[model samples]
Target: MARTRIIEIDPLTRVEGHGKVTIHLDDHNNVDEARLHIVEFRGFERFILGRLYWEVPVIVQRLCGICPVSHHLAASKAMDSIVGVDCLTPTAEKMRRLMHYGQIMQSNVLHFFHLSSPDLLFGFESEVEKRNIFGIIEAYPELAVKGIKMRKFGQEVIRATAGKKIHGTSAIPGGVNKNLSLAERDHLLQDIEQMIEWAQEAVAIAEGYCVDHLSLVQQFATFNSSHMSLVREDGAMDLYHGVLRAIDASGNVIFDQVDYRDFNDYLMEEVRSWSYMKFPFIKRRGNLDGWYRVGPLSRMNTAGFIDTPLADDAHQAFRAFAGGRPNQMSLAYHWARMIEVLHCVEKIRQLLHDPDLQGSDLLLRGERREEGIGVLEAPRGTLFHHYRVDNNDQVTFCNLIVATTNNNEAMNRAITQVAKAHLSSQKTIPEGMLNKIEVAVRAYDPCLSCATHALGRMPLDVALYDAAGNLLEHRVKDGR
Candidate 1:
């Protein structure tokens, strides 16, 4: 009889919050199963009840410090429909778009340079202590400086558009609370050219990295799945606003121009015993057959074209590597992320030139409706915020499908694939093999804090089971 063993990685390092990986081995030491588990829970949906509709935007922004602007704007958009406005003032719309672009720029750079770059710059098997931003700075000081300055420029843009960078109160029901002043606009423009140059360079570096590691990019947690994102009427990528679009693994359009309110018609959520995060799937395909992905890779695959000229050219080069198929390579997420950062820089420059950004018509007063649904493409992916109000304008029901939750099923599937590829039939699992599994999870850039919405301290615990379902090993990390 063959002996069985298990491998567990607790509190996946360099991620946003607490999560774990558990790989079960069979009698033959073959990989039996793998799971990515979210261990925390936050009941934001239940706690928001009885609050005023307008307060929802402010309260929900506390979901995650990294992407608070996404929740802030998504909640504000939902409240806008409740207040009976179909469209915001020209200035309000432009200002909100600017703020959103800044959020995306900063977020993309943070992930590419601070969180994920270590894996790319240093070998995946490099020393854990040395695989970090400081290491990158020591080796390539110029590139590190550029990334820092680029992120700083994005944060400054956010501060200029909104009152502050994180948890800003600029977006409100029906419109924004403030507009961008002429001086503020001019100040932001000062670094636009340099930001664009840095973004373009980043894209080239990412593309080169993908090319250099072509084999790893092709095989690392790569599999076929459906892709989803919001797109303009012409099928151009629109991060701030658009209709929902989904495509299958073969690049066939599954659905297009979907309204946010009618999302229930095509999407459904499944609760898993192993995870606090809900798995979302396409209703038409059912649970097992309906798993889809969101975020940079999904967004790049679903859209027909990027509107910005420079980014559009870069996008074409990105597609050429896939040979006209949906880019299913999971590692290419880094490439897609850099492309998005380029698009955000170009979009920000264009919006800064618009005179409407300086207009004084900031707010619109209106009556309340019984319900409202707000949807927008966040830095991670599509984010949904729905709310129902009582006669007194108090919230009665709230539902939020965060970006990380939408990709939960896909992430688990990817983890299983990585475990099978690297750990199956192995008598001794190396630390590098475990790091590869974490790399699969990191590729998705999941935000567990936002996905679980949990309060209090978070801890990650991973337990491995033998073929007889006996706990063989356990690893735990206290996130507090």
Candidate 2:
């Protein structure tokens, strides 16, 4: 009789979600199947149903520490649409874009150096402790310092442009609450320059990895579908807000730019019973064939071209690998992240230089309650926050579409692929492969807190079983 094997991760820690992964393998080295599950339900929608209109941003920003800007922008956006007024003037619009650029820079850099770099530079066999950002502190301190400085400088811009570092209250229904003082502007520019230098060094280091590890790229870059992102009809990178456009896997442009109302017509969410997260794909293409990815690579693929100069250069380098198509391998996320970092710096510099950004009045105060939706390119991907308010300015409906939700189908497919590739009979059942599969999902850097808002912590029970259904191992995880 051949031995049966199962790998289970119950209640994954150090990240969002009561998440788990299960892998089952048959005797004779055949891999049967795998699943990625998101447990627990918090009715964030129900919690906000009766709240005041302006309280939306305040309430939703607490969804996740990693992508609070996404929630804040989305919630506020829904209000903007509902009220039927685009409150921000040219200056306010510029400032909001700058704030959002800072968010994109910090978030993309965090994923690059902290989460994904360890797997790229150090062998997966490297000690788990030494395989994180701290590992870089031990083995390659200068590179690690560059990463830290990059993140800090980007966050400093965020703090100065907005109010708080993580959860900020500057964005409002009509406009922003904060103004850009002269001193703060100078401080922001200085930080932007420093961020530029640090990002350049980080890019060089990543390029080294790209050059040295061809095989890793080959396995990690497998593309399953085409890509999508928000951009202008003229083909410029639209950061703060724009229409959504996507291309099929064959490189044919599907829809150049589609407005949000038509969002459901072109792209729709596929409800899956296995996970709370919904898979987003082009409506007509169907599920298995249509699931496209977002975040770094997809954003790079979908945009007609990048606007900023240095970012354009980096983008040129990225295109040299595989031009105008999805790189597919999750490792390519770094290349996309670096391109965006450069893009953020250059565009922010342009925005600051604009005369409008220096004006005194920052907001246009007014209240008009109507159905509205605000769509912006969150650091991870396109974020949609829709809201409906009654005549009394009370919120009645709220719907949020986050970036992670865009990649749900792909993540499941990836888990199963990783299982088949590495969990066969001849392969060793390593202790941390479950975490590795989960890490693949984290490559998208999901913000779970933004998905919902009600409060409930649930316990976890992970059970391993053989093909015949006999129990092999069981473990329970502590709930919050």
Candidate 3:
């Protein structure tokens, strides 16, 4: 009889939050199953219950430190609906857009430069100690410096609009709290051109890597799947606000321009016994086969065109390279991400020159409502925020379907594909082969802490094992 064994990478590195990957090998050494498990959980939805409706916008920011602005804005937009405001003032909308674009630009830069660049620049199987952001700083100092400055510029934009870098109370129900001053606009303008130039360079690097390594990019953790995102009324890429859109692998529309308020009618969340995170799928397509991907890759596939000039050209080239079909390569996410960065910088420049951002009309209000829903394209993907308020001004219900949760199933599939491709039929799994599995998960850029919505306490455990199936070290920490 052949022996069966399991390999686990607990507390996965480089990605946000706490999670692990488990790979099961059959008796013949062929891969049987692989799963990306969320070992940690945070109850932000439960925590928000009973709080005043107005405070939820600021409280939701605690869901993620890296993309707090996304949660903050999404919650605020929902509250806008609760207050019965269908549209915001010109100054208010523009200010919020500026804040959102800054958030996306900075978040994407951090992921590409610090988190995923090491694997892309150096080979995925490179030495563990050397394959990191520090190594990039040591070898490519100029590129590293540019990444820092670009991120700094984006943060500065946030500070000017949102009042702080981490969590600001700028966005409120129906509108924003402050408008951009002339000094802030001038300061941001000074660095806008350089930011655009650097963003372009980043896109070229990602694009070149994919073109040069076509075979690897095509087959590595890649499969034909459905994609979803938000798009402008005219079918342009609009991250801050738009109706819902989903497309299949062949680039055909599954759904388009559906109001986000009725998300319940189309989307369903499936809970499995094995995972703390929930898998979301289209209700019409059935839970099993309706699973789709979100984030930069899906956004690229769903967006009909980019409104900006330079980014539009880049988008056209990217689509042409895929023969006008949805690009299914997981590795191409970096390229699509950089294109978004470029588009953000372009939008920032245009917003700074506009006089509406400096207008005094900041707040608007109308008839009140009990329930509201808001959806936006976050740095990771589509984010949904829904809330119901009681007459006492207290929150009665809260439900959040974050970007990471939307991609949970897709990430697991990617890990399974990579593990089977690289580790099957091997006598012993090398550390490098393990890194390949990580590469696949990292492509999704999942936020485990945000996706995990399980309540109560759970214990944590850590174990180190040698190639000979012997435990080298074991540790466990009790959870409250």
Candidate 3 lDDT, 1-480, residue by residue in tens: 655556666656777777777777777778877888886677888889999999999999888877889999999999999999989999999999999999999999998998899999999999877788899999899999999899999899899999998898899999999999999999999999999899999999999999999999999999989999999988999999999999988988999999999889989999988788999999999999999999999988999899999999999988987888999999989899999999999999999999999999999998999998989999899999999999998999999999999999899999899989998987665667777887898888877777785322323234434445766444443332
Q: lDDT of each prediction vs. the true structure?
A: 0.87, 0.71, 0.88
Q: Please identify which of the two predictions, 1 or 3, would achieve the higher TM-score against the true structure.
A: 1
For residue 128, model 1's alpha carbon misses the true position, in angstroms, by 1.2
TM-score, predicted candidate 1 vs. hidden true structure: 0.96
lDDT tens per residue, model 1, 1-480: 665666666768666767777787777777877888887788899989999988999899899888888999999989998998878999999999999999999988998998788889887888866777889899889999999999988898889877897888889999998888889989989999999999999999999999999998999889999999999979999998889999999999899989877888999999999888999999999999898999999998988999999999989999898987899988899999999999999999999999999899998867768889888888888899989999998999999999989989888888899888888877665656777877888888888888888544334455666656677666665544
lDDT of 2 by residue, 322-426 (tens): 754556767676777778888888887887677776776766655575687777788777777777788888888877777767766666677777767765664
Q: What is the lDDT of residue 393 in candidate 3?
A: 82
- In what order do the candidates fall by TM-score, top score first? 1, 3, 2
- Per-candidate RMSD vs. true structure? 1.9, 3.0, 3.2
Instruction: Write down the TM-score of every candidate.
Output: 0.96, 0.91, 0.95
Cα misplacement distance, residue 156 of candidate 2 (Å): 1.5
Top candidate on TM-score is: 1
lDDT against true structure, model 2: 0.71
> Once superposed on the true structure, which residue ranges of model 2 sit more than 4 Å away at CA?
1-6, 11-18, 27-29, 365-369, 426-428, 451-463, 473-480
Model 2 lowest lDDT segment of ten: 451-460
Best of the candidates, lDDT: 3
